[model samples]
Target: MIQQVFSIVVPLFVIAAVGYFYGSRVRPEMRITNQLIMDVFMPALIFHVMIQEDFYPSQYLPIMLAGVLLMLGSGVIAFGLARLIHLPWRGFVPPAMFSNWANLGLPLYVFSLGDAALGAGVMLVVAGNILCFTIGTYIYSGKLSSLEVLKTPVIVAVILGGAFNFLDIRLPLAFDKSVEMLGQIAIPLMLFSLGVRLTRASWKDSRAGVIMAMFCPMVGVALALLLIELIPMSAMHQNILILFGALPPAVVNFILAEQYQTEPDAVASMVLIGNFFAVISLPVVLFFVLSN
Candidate 1:
């Protein structure tokens, strides 16, 4: 079991560490690289998984619904906590709601559960992406724009991918292989970019960041446990949801915070602190998840 956990976890952090070391030295600009991952690679990953021969939305509908509820429920909990703690909801709630589904989720699922769970993992990511862009944007900006949501490349990928799946359409083998090759770049890039981002994060708000780091996963796992009881799902789905709940805040939360000028420092603190904590939190979650 120890070996299993190490095999699954070490490689990922090692890659991120590489980026961290490089970032500390060179401080590379990743704006365009990040845009390419979001615009090109991530969408390809989503579309490829969605259009897989074995992919079936109906089989995972309950898990998808649970994923949506988990996000909303986490937001409500975070909002209440923010009020209780006298913190700004803009900074606290989004981190609580959005997790590192892309950076951590896809690889974690593939590593822990094997490639069989990849489709389900991607499905959860697609659902989270929709909420992140639509409701998540509204929470940050106070305006919900369907047009804006639709314009997001990941969202568009979900739409087109789902359409292809539902319509029983398949890309040519050559085209599919090309897209898959492109999609393969996204996960490593996400981890490396995450490492670079962490290098730039300020530790001035460490107190709030530490509090949020502890709070977010607790809220998420508690909700996941409750939902697991209420919702009937396969064991694999249950495990996926549980792991999803325990993941650190999405780096995008910091990005959005910076974009909106809504206490970006605090948000960055939460993101960095939460992820650092994940070094402990994730393995603990994996112990239970893999043990079962």
Candidate 2:
């Protein structure tokens, strides 16, 4: 059990650590890299995975619905908590609602649940990304953000990939390989970028960060438990949703905060600390899910 847990986690940390140390010494600029990821690599990955020969959107509808409930439930809970604690809702709620489905989640699910689970993981990510880009962005910047969501590359990819899957359209073999290769770059790059982004977090905001680091997973898991009882699903999906609920905040939360000039520092703190804390949270989650 311990070995399995370590195998899933160690590689992610080691790769992120490489980014952390490199960023510390070189202070490399990441704007262009992040742009490329959002505009090119991540979209490619989403399309490649969704357009796979065996992929079926209908098969994962239960998981997809559960994922939506988990995100919306977390946001509601986080909203009440934010008001109770007087934390800026703008800074706190987004990270609390959107888990690190890409950076920590994709590989984590693959390693822990095996490659067969990748499609489920991808479905969960697509659900969260849709919410994050639409509702999450709206929360940060009001109504105008609606149009922006339409233009987001991730959302665009989801629409196109899902369309291709539904229509039974297949890319030519060589073109398919190219997209797969490009898609392959998204996950590792996401983890490394997470490390680089952590370097800029303000420890002074660690109090709120710590609060969220603990709060996010608890709310998510609670919601997941409730939803699973309400929604019948396969054991594999039940476990996948449970782990998804336990994931840390998405690193993109901080990116969006920065983009909107919200309390970017506070968001960064939550993202950095929440992920650092996941080293503890995830293993416990694994023990629970795997034991059952």
Candidate 3:
């Protein structure tokens, strides 16, 4: 397990580190590349994942409940904590609620569990996406937009991808080939872009806020593990859920923060803080859960 995790995390991180270095060396270029990855490359990748996987809707019911409950529970708990700390509504909600479902969870699902697990994980992401675009956006921006929710990339990806998968409809060979090529770029590009994005973040700034952000995910980790144990999930799926809960704040949070005029910097800081802690926190949490 140790080696498996190391192998999975090491290369992506190494590449991301290199990307950070290059991004630092070339600022504007990196920004453009980040935008491109987020805007175009990522959507293609998501579409591919959505379309290719065979989703088992019945098997996913409990997992879906777990995901949604964690989101809502964590959101309220984190929001309360943030409020206690006197964080503004803008800064308070994003880190508190957003689980790093994208940059972290998806890849970990692919690596740790393989195809079927990845399919289940995709369902989880789809649910997360709906919450993010609709409720999450409202919480962050202090405004409502049903139209934007329907238009969100992740939502669209889920709906369209499900349609394609269920209908057994295949894309044209040419378009499928194109999407595959572009989709392959998603992980590397996003990780690199994340690295580039981190360049502007001060690792030391917002220490208190960062610490506070870690608190909720810890609670979430405990809750998730307990639920897995009590709820009768398969051992492997339980492991996945525990790890998913252990994941750092969602990258989507920071993106939404920027999009909706939330506290982008604070959200970024929470991600940085949560990720730093995750290296130690996840393994220990996993050890405990698995041992149990």
Candidate 4:
């Protein structure tokens, strides 16, 4: 078990560590790279997975529902916590609600659980992206639009991909291979960009950040445990849900915070500190998950 844990965890952190070293030393401009990731690489990855001949959307519906419920459950708890602590709902709730699924989740699941689990993991990410763009955007910007959600590249990829899967239409091998190659770039770039983002993070709101850093995952895992008791799912889905619950706040949380001017400092602290805490938290979750 220890060896399995190390095998899964070590490579991820080593790549991230290299990114951190490069980011701190080189401080390369990441805006274009980040845009390309969101607009192209990630969508290609999602589309590639969704359009695979073996891909069956219905098989993973439970996991997708679990992901939605997890986010909503976390949001409810975060709302209560925000009111209790006198923190702005916009500042605390979104980060608490959205986990770092895209960056940490895809690679972690693919590495630890193997290729069979990748579709389920991608489904979880798609579910999160839907909510993050619509409901989560509403929380930050005070408006929601179906058109706005549809305009997102990842959302478009998911919709089209699901359609192709549902209709059992496989793309030609040459085209499919091309898309797969583009998709493959996303995971490593995601980990590397994560490290770059971390280098720019500040520790201004350490106290509140620390509290939220712990609070976010606690609420998620607790809700996941309760949901697993009530919901009958496959072992793979259960493991994915638990790991999803254990994930830290999304780095996009800080991006949105900065964009909307909604306590970016506190959000940044929560994002950075929460991720740092994941170094300890993820292994514990993995131990329990793998034991099962």
TM-scores of all predicted structures: 0.97, 0.95, 0.85, 0.97
Global lDDT for candidate 1?
A: 0.89
Which lDDT tens digits does candidate 2 get at residues 164-279? Answer: 98899999999999999998898899889878877876667988899988997788888988999999888889888999999998878887888888898898889888988998
What residue runs in model 1 are displaced by over 4 Å at the alpha carbon? none
Give the per-residue Cα lDDT of candidate 3 at 69: 79
Model 1 poorest 10 in a row by lDDT: 141-150
Descending-TM-score candidate ranking: 1, 4, 2, 3
The order by descending lDDT is 1, 4, 2, 3
Task: Report clashes for each candidate as comma-separated counts.
Answer: 0, 0, 3, 0
How far is each candidate from the true structure, as Cα RMSD in Å? 1.1, 1.5, 2.8, 1.2
Q: lDDT: which candidate is best? A: 1
Which residue runs does candidate 4 get wrong by more than 4 Å? none
TM-score of 1: 0.97
Residues 19-55, model 3: lDDT tens digits: 6788788774565666666567767776776666455
On the 0 to 100 scale, the lDDT of residue 175 in model 3 is 92
Q: Tens digit of lDDT per residue, candidate 1, span 113-166?
A: 988888888888888888888888887888788687788898889889889999
